[model samples]
Target: MFHNFLVTTEHRDFLRFLWHEDNDISKPLIDYHMNVHVFGNSPSPAVATYGLRKAVEKAETDVQDFIYRNFYVDDGLISCRTSEEAVDLLVRTQRILHDNGKLRLHKFSSNNREVLDSFPQSELAKDLCNLDLCNDTLPMHRSLGLSWDIETDRFTFCTCKDKKPFTRRGILSVINGLYDPLGFAVPVVLKGKLLMKEILSSTNSLDWDDPVPELFKKPWDVWVQSLTELEQVCIPRQYSDHSYTDSNVRLVHVFCDASKDAIGAVAYLQLFRPAGPEPTLSFLLGKGKLAPNGGSTIPRMELCAAVLGVEVADIIKEQLGIPSECFRFYTDSQIVLGYLTNTTRRFYVYVSNRVKRIHSASSPRQWTHVATEQNPADLATRSVSATQLSNSMWLTGPPCEILTKTLPEPLSCFPLVEPQNDCEIRPEVTCIKVQMDDVKPVNHKIGSERFLRFSTWESLVRGIKILKQFIYTFLKQSDIDSSEAY
Candidate 1:
């Protein structure tokens, strides 16, 4: 792809490099000029992308938006409703790029055998080039670094079997090694994160090489064994059967929940079909995080989870091209719903900052309440084995009651409690100031007039000392005058 773009004449000099012929010391070094962008060149990626974009703009094709949105640098990933549409779009894109910029768009692979058969064998991915589509079973392929089984059209996980010592470094390596970028494995991985946090905190002399405490050994072993079960779990790559062209009402439901240990949020894409009574719910994405250190209250944690839910919703909305109005947020906590719906009451800084963030991305009307049992995000706040997750609603989605056209009566509008009762609320403080009729204004140089000018603590302290001295002198002088008058 980088080879497709020719470097401008003036810039070729900067890309020049020294080369040796056949690695023979007998020959002198030869200077070469790079006429085309090469791998590792600083501007090569941008040049290639810009060339593709320019080609897309000039080409008369329907896949312009597809290329722009789906292409990550050179790899193009897209999904179509039918094999025919997929083939047509890809072929047109290939032709346009080839004719316009001499760019070859190849290595195409698809879940549909018809789509694969449409392309030339050479154009297909290397693994598919030699396989007989009719005789051989479809093999699993890596899409953007995730294992995708083309035969099943599902995403699968594989555990790294490499062995390591039972030490902090090894534990960390194992934790990060399982790369579920979409957070499909978050609930399972979250337990590991909480364990690591505990190991790091409770063990004072813990070094990278030091083994975890004996009490944690069994738990670590159990967690490691559970990873093998992840291979059994498979998630559908495609969200729904119907495409964007279908007359279906699309909605995104984001559920958030928190426990003592962690906070979690999950978003699902729901489609209300005209024929089907129940809406189809597909897992979009999920996120789980260990609660921050130094301790936090349940209400505060719930607020944090709400913020996370909004964040997940925003990402889904942006990627899916869905509008904000189509999104609905769910939380099991009345306190959190109260915080979001509260209009008259002000909150303390911790709650205020998070509430403001939630409000920025979503409005209060978009949020509703769900019972603890129905909130799928509950699975994320605590530990769940791979087997449990495979069957759990965390991946399957929430109960139908929550997705109905008319949501359960918004949890009784829980009135925002008084600030004094809730620490999260900022209590209204009143200050009384008395003015003396005979007292003159403070000195502009050293009194409250100069307080705002001090930018640092030291300067402010010094200014306050000067102001105190001035006030003492003025009061003493007034007393002396009163005595003389008497």
Candidate 2:
């Protein structure tokens, strides 16, 4: 059930004239203060969305649960094990949206003939299947942009053959044509994205539909041809069948890895069956990011991958409706592991912020090391042909044999490294300040500014202290050498 919630006057508290909309060119010239402030796919709709969801919290039990879990920014999506349950959910959900959230539920759809029969066709959105209307006809519905066959209960793709030339616009048309929001096609699609990057970065002024350089022309055409076969690749809509639901021993394992060209993460539901076999896994979702033009080193990229894993894991945790303890994150980089495990080691701002976010979603104990060879996210960082992605275990999990092997887990607490000698200088020189008699030591102001680098006066005093210490140490060493000579 997808619905629209009115952004009410309650959100406009002292926020009136501050919001304005430009007049349509053909319409009146006066600037109009817009009442609906949450338009244009803006982020502010979240504030109103939360209020509506919260309002529905105490409604009928099933409706409350549906409102809590299924709604995303006002669009509600849910699946039921049975048509009877669907009817109950549908009716209750409709009432809760209207009565409590003051929302109107519309655009309803389902494969079950009985479920659709209950609602007036006026209340339902037109089916995209382009098929004749009937009680028994199953239509193709788009759930969150992935093509879903209501009859088959599998995920499908809507593809169009690109007859356009091998130009910038043509390449973009074909690449953008792929609608794999769950990233099932990413390994295949990334090849095209990287190719597009090459073409765009090659010449800033290239016309949108102009012919590409001879180099990319062949590869671009080949990739476009491969896109049609993507429709042949269908995934089960649900991660696991209801009859085959995972036991409580299931864990959400998120794998992160990076290459110089890209970083990616893939999540899976690892289900441990009681039959004494290796834990099986079902692919939940995957994410990928191209390396920025301002290049980042491999370790930093790996850290970026780890941060991405945390975000993906946290999201899957919420969506899975599972206990938070059941979430685990894996990364192949020892550098990232050290950063995550070390409580005492301070890092540069970039690393620090990422580590903080990772720690926020997962405990240090939940982070485990996985061998690069065993990391499935490696496929995400590198390119894979459509055929390879379809057959390979990367989208799922590592093979069963690899999963059976035990990893030598790193210790949770990293021991702080001692200084080079008996010097009092800090391990992190940039972060620590040298203690000195401040002309007014005990009476220093409460909010005095701290400096990462020394000022001129402090530098002079610091230089003198270093020199004095060096001279004294040299004289002592000379005396010791003279005594040995005598």
Candidate 3:
């Protein structure tokens, strides 16, 4: 159609005007023209000229009318023999009118004059003309718009203005638009084969489930293996150096405490050979129950308990055969250690003094900190229900039978003695025995003294009468009469 129109003599002048040059056209348009008409090297001059002339005449005569009539149809359909011919005519006419400023308009109307007036100004009109020419080269049917469907195996295109039959070229164009810029430009006929190859290649080359191929043999793995080897080799040697022989009885005494909230604490003491565990005899000091006043602050209580523990250890060393210089102490209380070692703030002078004494006495003993979790003494300090306490005792090594039975009673054979006058009495007393039972024979002699023992009702009455007469005689000698007192 374009070739035939171009060859017609009468349309030659119109074509020149459409190209926007009486003398020369833009390089792009000239290239477009050369490619379509001459570069393909087809020997069909008459066919090309005839097509071009007809296209020009149709564009000049009725391009607007044809577009208006077909704008609403599926694919913007028209009665023209071919869509290509219609597009060519529309492009040529728009180009001519736009360059001459004849197509510039502000509105569209049925009247020819109104339609002409609606054409844009010169520059904008030229842009619209170029768009129309481009559209002519890639003529889009209104019905051939793009559609994507993941479920379908094939691409589909339908008219943009109305639903209509699909076209192969339309679908190809749509697919190209979708994938071309993403670098997949395989022709549609071969797209399925390419897709299948991609899928198979990925599946064959890589195992999705075993994604991390290097983790099993990576640097981290190698480092861990090296560490394990080092630990296995070194730990025994270290232990051997510190181990005790009968001739060199090294002692590692551990002190620990448990609390209800935080886990527990342990302290260690190391003694040299020949000295035996008795040198680390800090543990021999009797344990004291923590005062019931500060239950809420476990850390504070643990700290205080640790201070007491160290004090006890120090006293045991001095009083027992333990040499303070040979002892090495360990504790879970960082706070107590901090104060003792001057590592933290000190608040209690008494505790600090006790710590100093322990430090001075135990020349070989060094105080070290351990995490509460590793502290075994934790079991002793924390309150446990009877059952839990019983279970814990079983776990700890001891006179193993103590786990099954209660703690053994300490020896207390002497008769019950009244608190001496010089001694101040404590507010409460806890003793296993009181004076309610049968009187045991007393071995010690007493100086001459009046003594009353009430064994029955008659003896108790007689004793009261005798005590009342004595009190009456004493009062009369001191002063007032009995008659006035009653």
Give the TM-scores of the predictions, in the order they appear. Answer: 0.82, 0.73, 0.24
Q: Poorest 10 consecutive residues of model 2 by lDDT?
A: 416-425
Shift of residue 76 alpha carbon in model 2, Å: 2.4
lDDT of 2: 0.72
Model 2 stretches with alpha carbons more than 4 Å out: 1-58, 72-74, 96-107, 117-125, 128-137, 207-210, 242-246, 272-279, 343-346, 401-486
What are the lDDT scores of the predictions, listed in order?
0.85, 0.72, 0.36
**Considering lDDT, which of the candidate structures 1 and 2 is the better prediction for this target?**
1
Backbone collision count in every prediction? 0, 0, 51
lDDT string for model 2 (160-189, tens) is 853877778777787777877677877787
Model 3 lDDT, residue 202, Cα:
43
Model 1, 55-143: lDDT tens digits are 88966546788777888889988988788888889889988888877889999899999999898899999889999999898898988
List the pairs of residues colliding in candidate 2.
none
Winning candidate number (TM-score) = 1
